[model samples]
Target chain A: MIEKIDGFAYILGDDINTDDIVPSHTLTMRDVDEMAKCTLEFIDPTFAKNSAQGNIIIAGDNFGTGSSREEAVYVFKVLGIKAIIAKSFARIYFRNLINLGIPGIIVSWNESIFSKGDNLEISLNEGVITNKTKGVKIEFEKLPNFLTKILEEGGILNQLKKTLKG
Target chain B: MGYTIAEKILINHSNLKSISPGQFIDCNIDLIMVHEQLGGRIHKEYEKLEIDYVWDPNKIFFILDHWVPAPTISAAQMHQDCRKFAEKYKFIHNFGYQLDKGICHQVLPEMGFSRPGMLIVGSDSHTTTYGAFNCLATGIGATDVSVVFATGKLWFRVPESFQIIMSGKFNKGVMSKDFILTLIGNISTKGAIYKSLEFHGQGAKNLSIDGRMTISNMVVEAGAKFGIFQPDNKLETWLVNRTKEPYKLVTPDNDANYENTLEYNLSEITPVVAKPSNPGNIAGIEEVEGIEIDQAFLGSCTNGRMEDLRIAAKILKGNNIDPNTRLIIIPASKEIYMEALREGLMEIFLSAGAVVGNCTCGPCIGGHLGVLGSEEVCISSTNRNFKGRMGDPTSEVYLASPAVVAASALKGRIADPREVL
Candidate 1:
């Protein structure tokens, strides 16, 4: 279950790809903990250094596009990013994140209103995001019922295991 | 009722008759290839299905590229998994760090694994590069790959075809990279989603086999199922030199109908780059010149061809890379590496203070080598320059042609290849 979190927002522009989320160089390391130390080193080195665990990421269109590298999704999960709200997502990335049990919401309207460091409250179950600073509230289109069930089960792999075993 | 090169191949191989868009039907896969990274997962997934042997090991090709020579223990584990899988299944083609082992797409055609009128699937997105030979190739998920392993066939929706015809001649310093980027800009990235793109025109004949591969390599970025150019004597000659197997030639019928047709005059094309955040966010090199860059990379299945090396070498022959720049060269395959050595392109790059690395994908994926630091800016030849693409979210990556990357390496800033060439 996703809980409402009041955290600082890191506003990113459109098309934040998987490569930027996780560098390919770190793929050499097997430990997710060690690799997470350098997450977002290209975009903000301090991101890995100073980021509080479970920060919320708000982005524009086409998030997680480019090279279906699963490591890209894995890095964010390891970095403790709570939820990613974007206007839209690349098809494979959306699936991969859901499979990894990451909460990704697609909010089509008022995406530009939220900026960096805004104190935002998100309710995953309600699909509502309220920006207290801007006095704006946005409703995200929830994942389909079937996908919600998969996410609840902790990812597609776990879901698959359960289904196969049952 | 029109058929594209991708559609025709799918129809001929379709288990059912007369398939259309949105209707998925199982069809046999002519080739199932995987690299070190995803191959291990495929094997593990296969184990879950309790499969002793793959449907047709002969048609499956496994390579230890990507993180090969094992950059770390995890990467080594991936290789180990692939090695065991290959041995257990008796897969016909298993390549390590030796000769014939390179980027799957490059070595596949170089060793004649791809042919006209065939359907190929790989775990990597650039698998569409095989479509340059008029084959239908696309990437699939790991579970889907397991399904393909258990059965020789997987299902696909018949994609509509978009015909792109290019005429006129290319301007000086313009390359295939520019032409393809121009199309992405014109059509938008998702403009051709789930469609096969067929390139035809007198100007296409002007491109070499390697150039054609570079153009088709990034078809996935435009959300297309694949991009293909009809085969000609150049492709046939290359295939004949590599394999002795009988090959078939296929093309769209003279009256083949297309859902949409677009024409480009090649002469109007200029050196282009996809600015940070999106591949479709394109601008000509002239528009962004003098933007300082911290890195320059020349490799990837896209621009890592022998001809791409020659272009970069020619530009860097006597010029030194800017002290502020970190330039790295990754040849697509071992064959390209040896050929570059024989052609003295390696010396030119080395003399320019550039680091020449092995045939594996390096900084392109932001893996081991060439990780960009925060606030750094890079000009690279690899497809895709989305935000945080090369390392730091603060660092920026600009995608361009080999010549542009080489020129940028020399100047420590994004540049027009025409200035150096």
Candidate 2:
């Protein structure tokens, strides 16, 4: 659905869990935008104030490795995250990204590929990630056709709506 | 070629008669279990789809375990919303604080909703606890659960499975919790990412259903999609009185494929604890002994069963917790709580300076009850020890079995269970 996502890389370390993304206590908040303010508060207290729209989050292995809370993914959406490129991801977290129409690209484990604030352009169509700042190009696998179809429909809800209407 | 238990269950649940790992298929779910998030988030997502009614009310388990007794006004509103949804749908298995239900994972199995060869999904990650019954179960997000409600089907990628062969027996004061922690320590948190962990062999067979549930519940910490056990006479006997529904049992066929194989001798395992920040950061009891703790929490879906309470009570009997340390005890369900009361375990706990709370997933998730403050350190029987997991980000949590927690509470430090026992 989203052929390309161009943004600056927001770097995080390995094993960034769901708890880091959305703390459990914050889930009680009524406003989504207000809840997003607590994203990664412990890891980077300024993540809420510093992160801007369309920034790509690049992290090491097992990103989003705790809990099945979809609020973790919803926080990224509310913050306008363009895409997440991690060396790996926990299963439920990755699926939530796909269902919410966010591209979660899995790149090989190479922490040296991008630095903080590096301009990166990910072309989902070509399966290539071009670190425009560093002049490096990396190839990754595209999402399966079925999953891409869900993304194209703007999320699982839209896809489900189509199915139900039919 | 023979099929693994996961493959067998998926094949039986889906239109396909056969499936290989990584092949995605639409599977019919036998049950969908949801908790507070159902009212808090899932209802909004489900409303977006504009479906008038859920596919089948009978197939849903509407539970309000987390934030039960509504810790805050916001949580109370969420409970009200869940009540509205349950009332509208008339869910057959609806439960709330009023009904005196505990955690969703424990209640589902105790209610017999978790049966052999069934495929279950829950909004909570520990839903994998049902796999102790030899069923295929995994956690899903709110959006996915909403879609399943609209149409009782969802997509699943057939996961590659690992065969964990457990041999030998446990030493005194050691538990299934210790063995599971050892496995997670050897294989880091993401070792089983997107894979099924099929547990079997002598050590696994020797475990009681409660012990098996404790093991299966936290396999998600290893990033496993499912933690299924092979059906044995223990599970069969346990299910006979719980469920009258005719059910089939599934076993991994001989010569079934596995992504990898791991063998563990449970007898060699000793009391272990996962230190601050991560469940994979395991240390022997002796390694972290005498490390002072501010609190000792003994509850959660992971280790809140009667078996766990009995273990903790045995250690706490005739002994009081340290003056500096606070101990909080919560059973996983009403049944477990009643059983503990009948056994006088509640009396022992109350006399031991432990604040026995109602059955709720309170402090384990840092939702309420025993939330830790900044600079506070706790020894908890719950699964995760992630930073900020139990309240303030600076608060540190150490994960261990209930026995370890009880000993730590008695000493006001991370003490060895062997000493207390």
Instruction: Please give the DockQ score of every candidate, comma-separated.
Output: 0.23, 0.86
- For every candidate in turn, the CA RMSD to the true structure comes to 5.0, 1.1
Per-residue lDDT of B112-169 in model 1, one digit per residue for the tens?
A: 8888888898877788898888788887656556666767776576777888898887
**lDDT, residue B311, model 2:** 91
How close is every model to the real structure, measured as TM-score? Answer: 0.81, 0.98
What's the lDDT of the predicted structure labeled candidate 1?
0.78
Error of 2 at B144 (Å): 0.2
The CAPRI quality class of candidate 2 comes to: high
lDDT of 2 by residue, B1-421 (tens): 9999999999998988778999999999999999998876798899888768889999998888889888899888889888888887777777754648888999899989999999999998889999999999999999999999999999999999999999988887999899899999989999999999999898899998999999999999999999999999999999988999999999999989999999998889999999999999999999999999999999999999988998999999999999999999999999999999999999999999999999999999899999999999999999998999999999999999988999899999999988879
Largest TM-score belongs to which candidate? 2
Local accuracy of candidate 2 as per-residue lDDT tens digits, A56-158: 9999999999899999999988888889999999999999999999889999746568888989998988889999988999999988999888888879999
lDDT of 1 by residue, A1-166 (tens): 6567577677776666666776666655656688888776767777866556337888877777666666666667777776788877765566567767787888775445777777889877787888888898888777666667767876665655555467
Write down the lDDT of every candidate, Cα atoms only: 0.78, 0.91
Give the range where candidate 1 chain B is weakest over 10 consecutive residues by summed lDDT.
B37-46
